[model samples]
Target chain A: MQKIEAVIQPSKLDAVKDALLEVGIEGMTILEARGHGRQKGHTEFYRGREYTVDLLPKIKLEMVVPDELVEKAVQAIVSSARTGKIGDGKIFLSKIDEAIRIRNDERGASAL
Target chain B: MQKIEAVIQPSKLDAVKDALLEVGIEGMTILEARGHGRQKGHTEFYRGREYTVDLLPKIKLEMVVPDELVEKAVQAIVSSARTGKIGDGKIFLSKIDEAIRIRNDERGASAL
Candidate 1:
């Protein structure tokens, strides 16, 4: 099985989720994160004062799918999350040795 | 080397951290999350109205560990996070091929 992790702009989360669902991908874990990347932080005004915020808010989506679905899932994310902007974010693919559903001891891809 | 991702109850965060530290695993990333599993969500009253909230708050801890320490690290987390209850959470292990520390371009396991 393979795990697809995509770090994306917060604003694009709903679209990405919908896109994945359209492709028949349902189960996923989402996390809130702060990302530091090529795009340097910018100054923003809050309460009439400017502050330099270095780490930008980001959303990370993680899912484990059967090997066959990896490519489709990645494409779904790319199409939905892209905004022609620098921080559109990144997708990472990795191999999962085993997956066990804590509830019923379901193992392997079925557990996913 | 393997990357250990643990989705655990928010209340167990501190104990899990201390357990990992005791086992010599230091660096880790923590994120806020919501989880849905066998332990179904319950209804809660808000503003004098009852609402069925399905997803529950969770904490996700992620770290890449050297191959030799995967077992030990998993043990630490299991021991610390387990509450003998329904939603104690789960751990996932995956293979990482090229971890790069964005700051200095460090690669491989060293970047972890």
Candidate 2:
């Protein structure tokens, strides 16, 4: 199995989720993160003082799918998340050795 | 080496942290999440309306560990996280090709 992790703009989360669901991908985990990527830091005014905010708010979506679905899932995310902007985000693919459902001991793709 | 990701109940966060610390696994990332598992959710009244909330608040803990520490780390989490309840949560192990610390150029297990 492959685990697809996408670090995306917060504003693009709903679109990405809906896109994945449209492709028959239902189970997913979402997390809010602070990312310092290639995008340069920008100065912000806080309490009348300028502060450089290096880390920007990001949303991370994670899901484990059968090997066959990896490409489709990636395409779904790319199509829905792209904004022609610097912080459009990136997707990472990783190999998963096993998956076990904690509820009933279901394993492998079925557990996913 | 492996990456250990645990989806646990919010109330069990402290115990899991202490358990991991006792085993010398200090670096971890925590994310707030909503999970829908075998544990049936309850109903709540919001704005004077009843809602069947199938998804419950959860805490996701993630960390990369050396190969030798994988077993030990998993044991620490299981021992501390188990509450003999339906929603005790689960742990997932995945292979990591590389890990690079964003702050520096450090790589591999050291970056962890």
Candidate 3:
């Protein structure tokens, strides 16, 4: 299965959730994250850079879905999370070896 | 590189973190999570199930490390986080194509 991790603006959570649910994704794990976006570098070590380092409050949405739904899920996130601004955030894709549900030891897709 | 995600008990955060640091992993992203574990299924649809649905507080630790560190990192997490109980949580392994530091656009291993 493909795991989709989307780091997005905090304000866009509800809209993104609605969009995902509309596309048939119901379960997801949401996390509050600090986004290392561009901020002013305060020390000499990073002073010369074109941009500074800053951490913005970001919402990370994670879910593992069947491989076939990867592209569709990505589109749903990007379209809903984009703000035409630099801090719109990013999405990372990866492959999951297996998934086991702790409740009943259910494995694979059924567990998901 | 591999992305190691451990959904562990909130109380084990400190110990798990120390374990990672001892193994040379310094950077990580932490998120607060709610874990769905066996609780009394309160609704009709889930009432007859062997277990119920309840959300427990969990801490999700995320980091991308060099391929060689995957095994060590997993061991560090599993060893420190296990409580010999059902809610100790689970660890997931995935392959990351690339990692980019948003602060300055540093990419790949350098970013990680």
**Worst-scoring 10-residue span by lDDT in model 1 chain A:** A43-52
- Residue A89, model 3: lDDT of 79
Query: CA lDDT of A26 in candidate 3?
Result: 58
lDDT of 1 by residue, A1-112 (tens): 8889899988788898889877877667787787776735665333465445556677888888889999999999999999885668899987888665544445678766
lDDT to native, each model: 0.77, 0.77, 0.73
Across all candidates, the chain A TM-score values are 0.87, 0.88, 0.83
List runs of model 3 lying over 4 Å from the truth: A38-53, B1-4, B8-31, B34-56, B61-91, B95-112
Q: Write the per-residue lDDT of candidate 2 for residues A17-102, one digit (tens) a residue.
A: 77887777766777778777653576533346543556667788888888999999999999999988677789999888866554
Number of the candidate with higher DockQ, 1 or 3 = 1
Model 2 clashing-pair count: 0
Q: What local lDDT does model 3 show for residue B81?
A: 83
**lDDT of candidate 1 over B4-77, digit per residue (tens):** 88888787899999999999899899988965443224553334654333345778899998888888987888
Q: What shift in Å separates residue B34 of candidate 2 from its native position after superposition?
A: 4.0
TM-score of 3: 0.56
In CAPRI terms, where does candidate 3 land?
Answer: incorrect
- Candidate 2: segments with Cα more than 4 A from true spot: A39-53, B15-29, B35-56, B66-88, B96-112
2 against 3, candidate with superior TM-score: 2
Considering every candidate listed, which one attains the maximal TM-score? Answer: 2
